[model samples]
Target: MSCLLEVTALCKTYRKQHGLFRQETIKALENISFQLHAGKTLAIVGETGSGKSTLAKVLVGIEQPDQGEIRLAGKVVTMTNYRKYNHVIRYLFQDAERALNPSQKIGDMLTDVLRFSTVLDNLQRQQKVLESLQQVGLMDEHIDFYPHMFSAGQQQRIALARALILDPKLLILDEALTVLDPTLRAQIVNLLLELQQQKGLAYLLISKNLRLVRHISDHCIVMQHGQVVESGPTEQLLTQPQHAHTRKLMGMS
Candidate 1:
């Protein structure tokens, strides 16, 4: 249960042209801070434009924070050294189909990850790919299938397999479960929890689904206007929200 990720005073801003000469500054995230531990899940729940997605992108190195510090396993993470941490922290996007290439077979796609990130030979990479597929409840037969060949749920499983291929300690899920139906979402949640227990994985879930956050997360933070309005243990925060924004999110009067 050691701390695996620490984010402090994270800030991000963007300037957009308003008119021919005027411009507007938008603060996406302001002084955001949090901690996540091994084998735990931390859920960020917010409305659209609340900066949840921005935080995900920053954590995964897709975007740089204007001012902040990110530490993984007590080591500072900067854009310059992000490549060293890429294998230890991975991202799973919401759209599995869009994240995957339709023309590539699942096996080749997975092998490519190992081919670049690892020193394993062809035989070793193939073995690792099969192992990763099995970790997400996929089978050997799925290795030859293209992205279009699977159902929405199965495609997500494949994406999960790819993320776990490198045996990452932290997985940032940017609305990864939002696209699935109730039943499929439940299945993926169970699978994710199982994987966490088995591999001691940590998850940073960016989502708007309150029910999913309550069920799967150990702690929850509610964001509004690009700031955290409330944060606490998941059950406590959900059942007894303190902030007006959080109450509104929960449909409370």
Candidate 2:
């Protein structure tokens, strides 16, 4: 597979306020580097405040890093050119409800997404929308329902459909599976795997669920306090974690 996304010495920092007037800088990510290949899933595992979400935000152009560079498909990823990358990249937020509109019908929401698309005609757009919904296990009848009317898992499926509707080459899922029940999480994981196989899509999955990550990821990055303590092929890293932090994270002595 080709390298779809590359990060070189990526860094991010935030302002830390110690008191009313005192402030310091907190490093969110330090020298973080990785390459995400097409048609594979890379899982990022870390405790709270370890910068996994920050990395996802940076990749999706939601936040700018303090230093280093990111290249997507050989093009520099910048705020100015981020819109141009939308066709090839999509982000599935952890809060699917917040990501969706409450007032709009599902069909209309899908239709609105086409306002940014250049490939589909009216009929083609509707068909593509239906196809995307179907891919997520929703029926055509779901098209007329509002987001507030669906279950959490179904809402998440809608969000996934929205991301897939654009036929993105790279997807950043920031704790997307965290809110689901075990059965639903497993179902969605299977759906994502199938999609990856059929579409050759690359995924950057952020999660604290080691069990889920172990099942889904090709590679894993173990982070602690904004630093990557260990990273390797998922099986190797999970089975033979070398870092004390990684071993602790995996609950292995």
Candidate 3:
């Protein structure tokens, strides 16, 4: 399979205030690198502040790297790159509430996205929207409800539906299932696998949930202090983690 995305020696730094006037440059991500293949999931696991979220932001063009390069589909990524990639790369944020608009009904929000992208006609767009909702196990009636009216899991499904509406090539899930129940998480995970088989969708899954990641991801990369410490086939790395950090992370005896 061809590489859908590649990050080479990526780095991000920020200045932090330590005192009234003193400040220091803190390296958030240092020389990070990875490749995501088409129709496969690559999970990046680490504790909070391991730069996983930063990496997701970079991938979705929300943050610029101070150094290194990111290539999407054989071309280098730049600020202007998002104009094209906006249709390809979408990020499912950790917070479902943040992902949805408080003022708009769910259906209207999705309808606007379809209208703005202009990918389908009004009738076709409505059909596709309803199909996406159904895929997430939501009904047409729920589409007219406000996001706050639904449970966290239901809101998450709506978010998933919105992301899938564009038929994106790469989905960057930033702790997306954190707010969901275990059973619901399993449902979404299975849905993702089904979608991958059906649509050839690729995923960059960022999560702290080890079991779910191991089950869903074909490739795995363990990050520490903003760099990948262990990476390989998910089964190999998880079953017999060579790195001490990886072993410690999974709590293997």
Candidate 4:
């Protein structure tokens, strides 16, 4: 598989207020670097505020990095040129319900993404929407329903559908599986694996779920205090972790 995404020394910081007049700078992501290949999964595991979410936001253009660059499909991308890459990188968040507008029909939500896509006509866009929905185990009838009309799993499936509509090369699964129950999570996991096989998607899975990480990731990276503590093949890292932080994550220390 080819390298689908690359990050080099990415850094981000925030000026957070400590009190009414005092302020402090927080290093959200520090010198982060990694590469992701097509049809692969990289798991990012850490406690809260580990910069996993910050990294995702940077990759998707929601936040700008303090330094470093991002490359997609071998092309340099920044905030200005990021829109060209939007169809290539999609983000599925933990809160599937909030990803949609309650008043909008599922069909409208799916089609709205095409407003930015110039290649597809009305008919092609509609077909693309239906095909994307089907890929996630949804149906045509779903397009007519509201966000409140589906179960959590089904709502997540719609979220996946929305992300897949543009046939992205990479997906930032930022705790996308956290909200579902065990059975539903397992089902979504299976669906994700199937989609990978079918579409050759590269996944950046950010989650605290060790079980899910072991099941779905080919590689794992442990993070703490905005820096990577350990990284290796998932099986090796999970079984014979090096860093104390990693061991702590695995409940070994």
Candidate whose lDDT is highest: 1
Full-model lDDT, candidate 2: 0.90
Candidate 1 collision pairs: none
Per-candidate TM vs. native? 0.98, 0.95, 0.93, 0.97
Report the C-alpha lDDT of model 4 over 1-253, residue by residue, as the tens digit.
6888989999999999987999998998999998899999999999898889999999999999999989898999989987889989999999999988899999988898876764788999889889989899988889899999999999999999999888899999999989899999999999999999987998999999998899999999898999998898999999888999988888888
CA error at residue 224 for candidate 3, angstroms: 0.7
Ranking by TM-score: 1, 4, 2, 3
What is the per-residue lDDT of model 3 for residues 47-84, given as tens digits with 9 covering 90 to 100? 77889989998888888899999888888988786767
True lDDT of residue 190, candidate 3: 84
lDDT of 1 at 215: 89
The local distance difference test score of each candidate is 0.93, 0.90, 0.88, 0.91
**What's the lDDT of the predicted structure labeled candidate 1?**
0.93
Model 1 C-alpha lDDT per residue in residues 134-215, reported as the tens digit of each score: 8889999999999999999999999999999999999999999999999999999999999999989999998888888888
Candidate 2 per-residue lDDT, tens place, 89-161, comes to: 8999998999999999998898889767656788998899899899999999999999999999999999999
> Can you list the residue pairs that collide in candidate 2?
none
Ranked candidates (lDDT, high to low): 1, 4, 2, 3
Candidate 1 regions with alpha-carbon error over 4 angstroms? none
Off by over 4 Å in 2: 18-20, 117-119
Model 3, residue 212: displacement in angstroms?
0.9
Using lDDT as the measure, name the better of candidate 1 and candidate 3. Answer: 1
Model 4, runs deviating above 4 Å: none
